[model samples]
Target: MFFAVIPAGGSGTRLWPLSRAGHPKFLHPLTGTDASLLQATVERVAPLASADRTMVVTGVAHVTAVARQLAGLPEENILVEPSPRDSCAAIALAAAVIAVREPDAVMGSFAADHLIVDPNRWVETVRQAIVGAEQGLLMTVGITPTRAETGYGYLQCGPLIDGGPLRRVEEFKEKPAADIAEAYVRSGRYLWNASMFVWRVDVFMAELARQQPELHAGVTAIAAAWNTPEREDVLGTVWPTLTKISVDYAVMEGAAEAGRVATVPGDFGWNDIGDFHTLGEVLPADSSGNVVLGGEGTEKPGALLWDTANLVVVPYSNRLVAALGVRDLIVVDTPDALMICPRDRAQDVKKLVDELKSRGEEGYV
Candidate 1:
């Protein structure tokens, strides 16, 4: 059996303006759907884990909203952290809780803010990854790169394992330069690292202990007090002591080096929504190549375009947004802020968020 866990906590600074500290992008309907991204993520895994068995690890700030969005899930299943401790701590906390209930349970960790167009194929990919989990191998679902993407890390795949779809992960490569990303796609042996992981509860804990003992210990202590009255006291005391790092640097990369990691190629359409440009790709576009994300709290500003090609407009506010003679631009409109940048500079949004904090304009961040 599989128990799904969603680490529903990220500032999503890249998708800022629309994605804010109060209401992140994961709480928004970025996929041109009525359901929010977090709801879609859980519904996608309903067959694998029911509401009782499923869990969500989120920050204390987002706990209320996370619970409101996932009303079907048990309130106790929402593991609230004292503060942001990165993916390693978030996932470790969920793994520890699952380990307490079902020592041999297989668990899959999915981000709260990603999109997969082909849900059925995604289920199949996870099912295959579960096969790898049963073998005590840490597995990640790697998306087949459709193009040269410099934003995502690449997984160098080795030979097949046990004559199955699973392949030994030769190495975990970080996000590469444009030329290197292109070469990786052309080599026919690389897949975009989507950060989707699956493993038995005990197996993942064992690997986590081997690679990040301190993190393992902290989460274990928190989980021990999870259901008790000391839950808040223990979490507030221990969570901040854990190292702040991503699972990639803390575990996945090292496990791959030990030949205990594997990758399952995912043919399903997947999008990390890293920036406005990527969000534009999955959205419906007009003949002029202008995509507008409107409606649902955001009135249709009715973006007018002339000779514009590849424009991503997020009209979050009621104000009218108009563009003319623009090409490959990203225009995000919020109630308090409006951000305009070239499509290529989509990654710079995070810098803008940092600059806002540096200038003490955290009210906008």
Candidate 2:
């Protein structure tokens, strides 16, 4: 059997204004539908498992929103985190939950805000990962890079597996500089790290025990208390104290050291939808190369844009915005805040968010 878990605990400050407190990006309608990212993620994983087999691990703050967005999923499948621990602890909690349910089931972990357009290819790739997991291999799905993007992690591809299309992972690299990213794109030897992982319950738990003993203790407690009232209370207490670490840093890196990690190059039209820069790539644009989202006056509604080219206007409301003699600029307006910056500087919006937070302007966010 196959099970899927989604981790949705991050505060998406990169997409500020629209993504505010108590409402993260996963709940935002980024796909031009009523379906949020969490909904889309659930739909993508639903075909791989039974209704009860899918789980969503998120923080307590967003539990209500998560519930409302994913009403199609079972209420018990929602695992609420009591505090802000990182991905390693979240994955441990998921593993413990699944271990109690199915002692030897194969499971896959994904993020709630990823965009995979081709469902058929995604299902096939997941099946391939499950096969790899049953053989006791920790599998990670990597995307073939289409551009020289320095924003994502990369994986060095090794030789192909003996009987399958999957490849052994030679190494993992963090986000690199522009030149290095371009060189990687030219070499065709690396794939963007999608953070998609698959492993069997027993294999995953054993690897956790070996590499992360402290986290292993937390997992042990949760597994021991499964189906009992103590599971939630004990996990709430122990999980917050867990070391904040990435699963890649804690498990995959060590697994690579032990020569047990593998990679499957999956081209399912994957996108993390992480930032505005990436969102622009997926959204529609005018002839002027402008991409707008989640608001009106997208292209100067009932107005004009004379002598303007390559401008993105994302108004928060139906307010009319007129632009003249502007090019390569992003104008995002909300009721509480308005942002106008060159498209090239869009990636640095995080710095602006930090400044806003330092100034105690939480309402703007």
Candidate 3:
């Protein structure tokens, strides 16, 4: 059986105003669907794992909202972190807990806030990864790069193993510069590291013990007390002491170097929805190339654009937002805050959130 673990952390500061610290982007319906990203993610993996076999690791602040969004999920499956400790700790916690239940289970970790246009192809890709995982290989689903995208990490793939589609991941590369990203795309050996990983709980725990012993020990102690009343006490006492690092840095990169990591290149119309420009690209645009959201099935659109080209506007205040003589701009209006920036500068939207924190404007953030 395959278990699905969704890491529903990350405030997604790049999509500010709409995606706040209290209410992150994963809880929003950014894909023009009624279901929020977290709900959609759980549903998307239903073919392989049911609600009982699925778990979500999120922060304490979002537990109530997460529970409200994922009503079918067991309350205990919703592992709440005392504080943010990055991906390694979050994922390790899920793995350790799963190990206690199903020591030989194959578990796949997927991000909560990504969009996959082709669910059928994605499911097939995950099936392939599960096969690799059953073979004692740590597997990652790598996306075939459609363009030179510098915003994401890349996996340099080696030869196909056993004359099939699965290939050994040669190296895990960081987000490269523009020229380096273009070079990586042109080489045809690089795949975008989407962070979708599949591995047996025992195998992953072994790797964790090898690479991140402190983290492995910390989560093991917490998992030992997970179903007991000591869960919260142990989590609060030990979680903050675990090293803060990404799974990529703490495990996958090192595992790749040790020839334990393999990847299946997937081309199922994947988008991270990292920023407004990327969101605009995935969503439907009007004839003027403007993408408007949050006004579906209503008398009027949430935004109005005249002489505007390639603008992404999200008006969530139930008020009509009008734009004129603007091109390639992102306008996001919420009840408490408004964000405007050039489309090219969408990646820098996190700066606004940081500035708000610097100014002690927590309410707006």
Candidate 4:
């Protein structure tokens, strides 16, 4: 049996106003489908791991919302974090807890905010990655780069082992300059690191101990008390002590350097749905290339797009929004705040959130 972990953190500040601390982007119906991004992720992995076996590691604040959305999952499967630590602690906790039940089970870590257009291809790709995990190598499902993406990190891959699809991960590159991103795409040896990983519980814990011993110990101790009356007490005390670092830095990178890492290229039409512009891709667009999301329909809430092509208007509020001669723009309207920027500036929306914090606009943020 394969256990799946969904780390549902991140406020998604880039998709802000619509995505807030209370309701992150993962909780919204960004894909135009009825299911929210988190719900879609759970459903996507349900074929491998049942609802009872799948676990969601999210902050205590989002626990209630996550539970409401994933009512099919067992209540205990929702692992609540006391505070924001990072992916290492979140994944480690789930891995250690599952190890207590089934030490040898293959566990896959998938993000809660990603979109996989082809579910069949996703399952098949994961099955391939699982095969690599059986060889005692850490495996990640690397999205085949479709374009020169400067926002996401890239993984340089080596020759395939045994003439199979699985290839050795040569290196993990951080988000690079535009020219470097284009070069990576042109080289054809890089894959976008989507943070999708599959490994056995025992193997993952062993690597966690080797790379991040303190985090491993902390999670192990907390997981030991998970079923007991001391679960909350132990977690509250030890979770904070776990080092605040990503699994990539604490484990995957070191594992890659040690030749203990491999990757399977997945061309499953994967998109992170990071910002409004990306979200527009998943949503339906009109003849004029204007995408409308939430609130009433395009005609009702009056998302009047006059000579507007390639505009993403999220009319989250009841108020009407009208755009005149706008092209390649994103307009997100919310009750508390409103944001308008060009499509190219979608990544810089996080900068706006930072500036808002600096300006003491905490309520809006």
- Candidate whose TM-score is highest: 3
lDDT for 274 (candidate 1): 83
Model 1: per-residue lDDT, tens digit, 18-43? 89998898898787766788999999
The CA lDDT at 69 in model 2 is 81
Error of 3 at 243 (Å): 1.3
User: How does candidate 4 score on lDDT?
Assistant: 0.90
* lDDT scores in order: 0.90, 0.82, 0.92, 0.90
User: Model 2 compared with the native: what TM-score?
Assistant: 0.90
Q: For candidate 4, lDDT tens digit of each residue in 261-351? A: 8999999889898888888886778998889876333334647778889999887777889988889999998888989999998989999
| Candidate 3 backbone collisions, by pair | none
Q: Residue 133: error of model 3 in Å?
A: 0.6
User: Per-candidate TM vs. native?
Assistant: 0.92, 0.90, 0.95, 0.93
TM-score for candidate 1, residues paired by index: 0.92
Residue 133, model 2: lDDT of 90
Better of 2 and 4 by TM-score: 4
Which lDDT tens digits does candidate 2 get at residues 1-365?
A: 88899998776776766677767888876764546788888888888987699999999899999988887789988988888778988888889889888899889999998877787899899888888899999999989999998889999878889965888887888999999999998998899999999999789889999999989888778768867978778876787779889999998888877878888888888877766666777767677776656534233243356778777666555576778898888776666777777778777777788888899987676
Off by over 4 Å in 1: 295-309, 319-327
Which regions in candidate 4 have their CA more than 4 angstroms from the true location? 295-306
